[model samples]
Target: MASRTFSEEDLSCPVCCDIFNNPVLLDCTHSICESCLQKVWRTNRARQCPVCRKRNSRDKYPLNLVLKNLCETFQQEIGQRERYCGLHISEFKLFCKDDNQLACLMCQDTRLHKNHNFSPINVAALKLKEELKIKLQPLQKKLDTLKLKDPMMELPNI
Candidate 1:
């Protein structure tokens, strides 16, 4: 049997369209981000999932920090997981800056490009890593230099 693959679009929350943070697995086994649930509860009396239509109480939308952190870790290891895509259940991708969305490559070259800036998976990953290295290298070098310098000879903290 052929194995399945997941894209960034799969792991994002439907309401906010962000990677799952504080994921809450409902009684019906449908998961929703705590923040999205909060938004619903804020503007609603009976908060229900937009997907499963399952009823949820306002107090139940507490953030699940543990699950949130876990997803973050996993997302780094694997950019996207087997979560469902909110927009296109059949297709997925990291994110499209041009369209301000996460969608399959086929969605590109569409009228969404009129006022959008679409980018690819590798572009975002590489750009972010490069930017971080550029910013962090100098700071790390400074820290090492300070550690090597004598405390008495160093200037006082301003």
Candidate 2:
């Protein structure tokens, strides 16, 4: 079986436009942030589904534990993509040109990277990608030659 992919919208609360925080399931089969639901109920003076406008007789709704867990895991996965400094627990936003390494703002202030030139992570990533592409051209040509020599061989795309 294959794993399913969920977009940010799938996990987001329509009221808050962000990931679900303490989500609650309504009688109408819709889910919303608990706080957001409370705010809407208070403002409108009615217990109803915000999305479908369906009136709910019950005052309390069940907490969507499964959705809450999914939202937390998704947030953690996103955080994992952005490298963080172990020492300061800050996101790496810059690349130290002299050291050829990623650095957080705290690391930039330290003496270890003193006087070293730095570039934004995006800029550094683009520069490195271009360099890698240039370096791989000859290797790619050689692989093409080999592929021609052995037509039956299935080489993985680089």
Candidate 3:
């Protein structure tokens, strides 16, 4: 089921629009953030929580593990999609052996790579990944050296 959430613009939730991290089930069964409940308690002396109509407890509320995991998974999927080729100006489908180019399904039938052997993008991507890994190694080593190097270098003037 899709999670119900308050609008971020509405200022109903500080962390997210819905699926509160530390959800406190009010007596009425409505859920709100534990922190939000505390804020409500500080402002109101009413015996019940405003949303759930439940009796207030002094102890801090426990975190909702299910909601936290859901949020994390959603965020990860979003991050993965943002890195996808569909969002890129260049579409990803066929790989040109000649130019090592990635093109959409349309580009393959066109004059762009008629003579070249076309391969699946995943295959080309594997080689490209190895190339990128090798290229990045030097930069990573330099970064590691910089991190370990002394801030102050002892030098005698030439």
Candidate 4:
């Protein structure tokens, strides 16, 4: 058997198109946010699975604790990946030009970074990307030349 990987869509509620908040599992085996389910039920005036339209007889459904926990964990992981600073456990909002590194606001006030030039993370990222593109141009041209010299050197399309 193959293991399946879940994405944000897999953890999201069909009704809200967002991560599940207090998700509830329907008899049809579909999960939806509790608030979104309430809104749908009120508007439709029916107890049914929002995804499949399968009628549900129960007035209340049990919360999908597993799915809820998965969603929360996924969100935390994504947040940590985005801009989190491991040292300070805070978001990286600035780029330290002197040290050429990302830094949280707390790092800015530290003695080590005092008087160091800083830029917004997004601005610094764009500048770095542009610089990288300029640097890679020559390398890319060389690779293209090599490919032309040897047909066997051609890379497969992803």
Candidate ranking under lDDT, highest first, comes to 2, 4, 1, 3
- Across residues 105-143, which tens digit of lDDT does each residue of candidate 2 receive? 999999999999999999999999999999999999999
lDDT of 1 by residue, 1-158 (tens): 12335556666777788889878766555667877777776887766777887876546644556557766765664544343354444345556665455656555545654556666666876777898999999999998888888675777878
lDDT of 2 at 8: 83
Query: Can you give the TM-score per candidate against the true fold?
Result: 0.40, 0.54, 0.40, 0.53
lDDT of 1 at 111: 66
Q: In model 4, state the lDDT of residue 143.
A: 88
lDDT of 4 by residue, 37-153 (tens): 889899776787888999987878899999998988887777667677777878899999999999999999999899999999999999999999999999999988987877764
- Displacement of residue 103 (Cα, Å) in model 3 is 11
Q: In order, what lDDT does every prediction score?
A: 0.66, 0.89, 0.62, 0.88
Clashing pairs in 3: 27-54, 28-52
Question: For candidate 1, what is the TM-score?
Answer: 0.40
lDDT of 3: 0.62
Worst 10 residues of 4 by lDDT: 1-10
lDDT, residue 113, model 4: 98
